[model samples]
Target: MDAQAWDERYAASELVWSREPNRLVAAELADLPPGTAVDLGAGEGRNAIWLASHGWSATAVDFSQVALDKGARLAEGLDVTWVCADATTWQPPAPVDLVVVAYLQLPAADRRRAVRNAVTMLRPGGTFLLVAHDSTNLTEGTGGPQDPAVLMTAADVVDDLSGLDVEVVRAERVDRAVTTAEAHRGEDRRTARDCLVRVVRR
Candidate 1:
C-alpha cells in the first residue's frame, strides 16, 4: 500500500498496531546501551517510543503522516522524532547506533532498496535489525500478507546487503504465536513465520 492508503487505514483505526514494542525487537535489543536509533517504516512509533522511554534518542520514519500524527500524540513528551517520509529513500542526518525495520513488507526491488538504505544509516559497529513475514508464511504460517511478492526470507534480506561491510548476528526464520478464537477457547494457538535479520556494520 502507498502512503495515502496507509493513511486511510491508520485513520480508520484507533491503533493499527500495539502500543508496546515488537516482541523480537525488545528481546534482542533490551541489553544494548541507550543510543541514537531510527525505526524505519515505523507504523505508530511503538518501538521508537519504547526506545525513547529506555533512554535512547529515537527517530520514527514512515510515509503516512496520519500514522505519525497518531504516534506523536501517543508519544507526547517522549524523545521520539516522527518523520513523514519514505523509508526506502529517506536518509538520517547522521549515522546512528541502531536502525530498525519491522514488518515493512514491500515488493522485492523496493524491499532490497529499503534494506540497503537502512544499513547506510548505521555507523560502524551499529546494529541493523529487520523483521517481516517470511515468504513461507503464506502457506506455512498465519495472519500475514497473503501476497507472496511482499514476503521475504532471511537469506533474501542478507543478500540485499551483500556488498555492505557487516557481520550477520542472526538471520533466520522465527515463530510468532498468534492467538485465535479457538485458542481463547482452549485450542492450540497458531504461529506466524517471520524472517528476522540482525547485523552489525563492521
Candidate 2:
C-alpha cells in the first residue's frame, strides 16, 4: 500500500496493531543493554514506545501521519521521536546502536531497499533485527498478507543484507502464536509463521 492507503487504514481503526512490542523483538533484545534505536515502518509506534520504556532512546518512522499521531499521543513522556516519512528513504541523524524493521511488507525490491536502509544506519557492533511474515505463511500459516511479492523468507533477508559487515545471529522462520483477534478470521489457526532475522554489525 502507498502512504495514503496506509494513512487511511490507520485512520479507519482506533488502533490497528497491538500496543505491545513484537514477540521476537522482546524475546531477542530484552537481554541486551538499551541504546539508541529506530523502529522503521512502525505502524502505530508500539515497538518504539516499548523500546523507549525499556530504556532505549527510540525513533518511530512511518509514512503514515495518522499512525504517527496516535503514537505521539500514546508516548507522551517517553524518549521517542515520531517521524512521518518513508522508511526506505529516511535516515537517522547518526548511526544508532539498534535498528528494528518489523513486519514492514512490501515488494521484494522495495523490501530489500528498506532493509538495506535500516542496516546502513547501524553503528559498528550495533544490532539490526527484523521480523516479517514469511513467504510460506501464505500457504502454511494462518494470517498475513497474501501477496507473495510482499512476503519474505529467511534466505531473502540474508540476501538483502548481503555485503554488509554484520554477523548473522539468527535467520529462520518460526511460529508465533496468533492473537485471538487474528484467529477470529478463520479456523485451524493457532500460529503465524514468520521470518525472524537478527544480526550484529561488525
Candidate 3:
C-alpha cells in the first residue's frame, strides 16, 4: 500500500495499532542499554514511543503524515522525533545506535532498498533489528498480508544485508500469538509466522 492508502486507514481508525511495542522488539531489545534509535516505517510510533519511554531517544519515520500526526499527539512528553518521509529514500542525517524495521511490507526491490538503507544508517557497533511477516504466513500461519510479494523470510533479510559489516545475532522464523481480534475470528487464537533478524554492526 502507498502513503495515501495508509493515511486513509489512520484517518478512519483512532488507533491503527496497539500501544504496546512489537513482541519481537521488546523480547530482543528490552535488555539493551538505552541509545538513539530510528523506527523506520514507524506506523503510529508504537515502537518509537516504547523505546523513548524505556530511555532511548527515538526518531519515528513514516510516509503517512496522518499517522505521524496521530503519533505525535500520543507522544506528548516523550523524546521522539516524528518525520514524515519514505523509508526507502529518507536517509537519516547521522548514524544511530539502533535501527528498527518492523512490518514494512513492500515489493522485493523496494523492500531491499529500505532494508539496505536501514543498515546504512547504523553506526559502528550499532544494531539493526527487523521483524516482519513471514511469506509462509499466508498459507501456514494466520493474520498478515495475503500477498506473497509483500512478505519476506529470514533468508531474505540475510540476503538484503549481505555486504554489511554486521554480526547476525538471530535470523529465523518465529511464531507470535495472534489474538481473536487480530485473527478476525471468534475466540480462535492462532499463531502468526514472522521473520526476526537481529544484527550488530561490526
Candidate 4:
C-alpha cells in the first residue's frame, strides 16, 4: 500500500497495530546495550516508544502524517525524534547503533533496496533487526498481507543483505502468540508466523 492507503487505514482505527513492541524486537535487543536507534516505517511509534523507554535515543520515520502525529502525541514525554518521510528514500543523519525495520512490506526489489538502505545506516558492530510475515503465513498462519510480493522468508532477507558480513542471530519461522483482545476482535484465530533476522554490521 502507498502513503495515502496507509493514512486511510490509520484514520479508520484507533490503532492499526498493537501498542507494544514486536516480540522479536524486544527479545533480540534485550541483551544489547542501549544506544542510538532508528525505526523505519514506525507506525504509531510503538517500537520507537519502547526503545526510548529502554534507553535508546530513537528516530521514528514514517510517511503518514497522521501516524507520525499520533506517535508524537503518544510519545509526549519520551525522547523520540519523529520524522515524516518515505522509508525507501529517507537517510539517517548518521549511522546508528541499532536499525529496526519491522513488517514494512513492499515489492521484492523495493524491499531489498529498503533493507540495504537500513543496513547502510548501521554503525560498525551495530544490530540490524528485520521482522516480517513469513511467506507461508498466508496459507498456514493468521491474517497478514496476502500479496506474495510482500511476504518473505528469512533466507530472502539474508540474501538481500548479502555482502554485509551478517551473521543471522535468529532466522526462522517463529510462532508468536496472539493476545486475547486480538483474538476476540477476529484479527486472527491463531498466532502469527513471522520471519525474524538479526544481523550485526561488519
Candidate 5:
C-alpha cells in the first residue's frame, strides 16, 4: 500500500499494531548498549518508543503521516523523532548505531533497495536488523501477507546486501506464535514464520 492508503488505514483505527516492541527485536537488541537508532517503516513507533524508554535516541520513519502523528502522540515525551518519508529512499542525517527494518514488505527490487540503503546508514560496527514475514509464510505459516512477492526469507535478506562490508550475526527463520480464536478455546495452535537478519557493519 502507498502512503495515502496507509494513512487511511491508520486513521481508521486507534492502533494498527501493538504498543510493545516486536519480540525478536527486543530479544536481539536488548543486550546492546543504548545508542542512536532508527526504526524504519515504524508503523506506530512502538519499537522506537521502546528503545527511547531504554535510553536510545530513536527516530521513527514512515511514509504515512497519519501513523506518524499517532506515534508522536503516543510518544509525547519520549526521545523519538517522527519523520514522514519513504523508507526505501529516506536517509538519516548521519550514520547511526542501529537501523531496524521491520515488516517493510515490498516487491523484490524495492526491498533490495531499502535493505541496501539501510545498510549504508550504519556507521562502522553499527547494527542492521530486519524482521519480516518469511516467503514460506504464505504456504506454510499462519497469518501474513498472502502475496509472495512481498514476503522474503533470511537468505533473500542476506543476499540483498551481498558484498557489503558486514558481518552476519544471525540470519534465520523464526516462529512467532499468534493467538487464535481456536487457541482461546484450547482447540488449535498457529504460528507465523518470520525471517530475522541481524548484521553488523564491519
Candidate 6:
C-alpha cells in the first residue's frame, strides 16, 4: 500500500497493529543484550518501542508520516528515533548491531531489495531478524494480505539473504493467534508466520 493509503488506514483506527511487539520478534530477541537496532518499515513503532523499553537504541523507519507520528506519540518518552522513508530505498546513517524487518509486504522484487538493503545495514557479526506472513497464510491459514505477490515463505526470505551467513534459528509454518476484531469476527484464523532466522554478516 502507498503512504496515503496507509495513512488513511492508520487514521481510521486508533492503531492498525497491536501495541505489543510481534510474538516472533519478542521470542527471538528476548535474551539478546541491548544495543543499537534499526526497525525497517516499522509501522506504529510497536517493535521499536518495545526495543527501546528494553534498552536498545532503536530507530523506526516508515514511509507514512502519519504512522511515524502515531508511533512517536505512542513512544512518548521511549528512546526511539522515528524516520520517514521508504524501506526499499532508505539507508541507515550507520551500521547497527541489530536490524529488524517485520511485516513489510510488497512485490517480490521490492521485497528482495528491501531485505537486501536491511541486511547490508548490519555491522559485522550483527544480527538480522525477519518476521513475515508466510505465503500459505492466504490459502491454508486464516488472515493476512490477500495478494500472493506480497506473501512469502521462509525459503524465499533465506533466498533473498542468500549471500549472508544466515542460520535458520527457527523456520517453519508456525501458527499465529489472531485476536483483532476484524479477524475474530470470522472463524478463528490461524495464519502462518515465518519463524526466526539469525544472520551474521560475513
TM-score to true structure, per model:
0.97, 0.95, 0.96, 0.93, 0.96, 0.91
State model 3's lDDT. Answer: 0.93
User: Whose lDDT is greatest here?
Assistant: 1
Lowest lDDT sum, 10 consecutive residues, model 3, at: 179-188
* Candidate no. 1 TM-score: 0.97
Clashes of each: 0, 0, 0, 0, 0, 0
The local lDDT score (0 to 100) that residue 124 gets in candidate 1 is 97
Clash pairs detected, candidate 4: none
How far residue 35's Cα lies from its native spot in candidate 2, in Å, is: 0.8
Model 5, span 47-164: residue lDDT tens: 9999999999999999999999999999988999999999999999999999999999999999999999999999999999999999989988998799999999999999999989
Instruction: Identify the runs in model 5 with alpha carbons over 4 angstroms from their true place.
Output: 182-188
Between the candidate structures 2 and 4, which one is better when assessed by lDDT?
2
Q: Write the per-residue lDDT of candidate 1 for residues 99-148, one digit (tens) a residue.
A: 99999999999999999999999999999999999999999999989999
RMSDs, each prediction?
Answer: 1.4, 2.1, 1.8, 2.3, 1.4, 2.4
- Those runs of model 4 whose alpha carbons end farther than 4 Å from true positions after fitting are 179-189
User: lDDT for every model?
Assistant: 0.96, 0.92, 0.93, 0.88, 0.94, 0.85
Which residue pairs clash in candidate 1?
A: none
Q: Tens-digit lDDT track for model 4 on 1-202?
A: 7889889988998898888898889987888899999999998989999999999899999999889888888888888999999897899878899999999988899899988888889888988998999999898877789888899998999999888766667778888776444645655446888999888888
Model 2 residue 98 CA deviation (Å) reads 0.4
Q: What RMSD does model 5 have?
A: 1.4
The global Cα lDDT (0 to 1) of model 6 is 0.85
Report the lDDT tens digits of candidate 2 across residue range 27-46.
98998899999999998999
Location of the lowest summed lDDT over 10 successive residues in candidate 5: 180-189
Supply candidate 4's per-residue lDDT for 135.
94
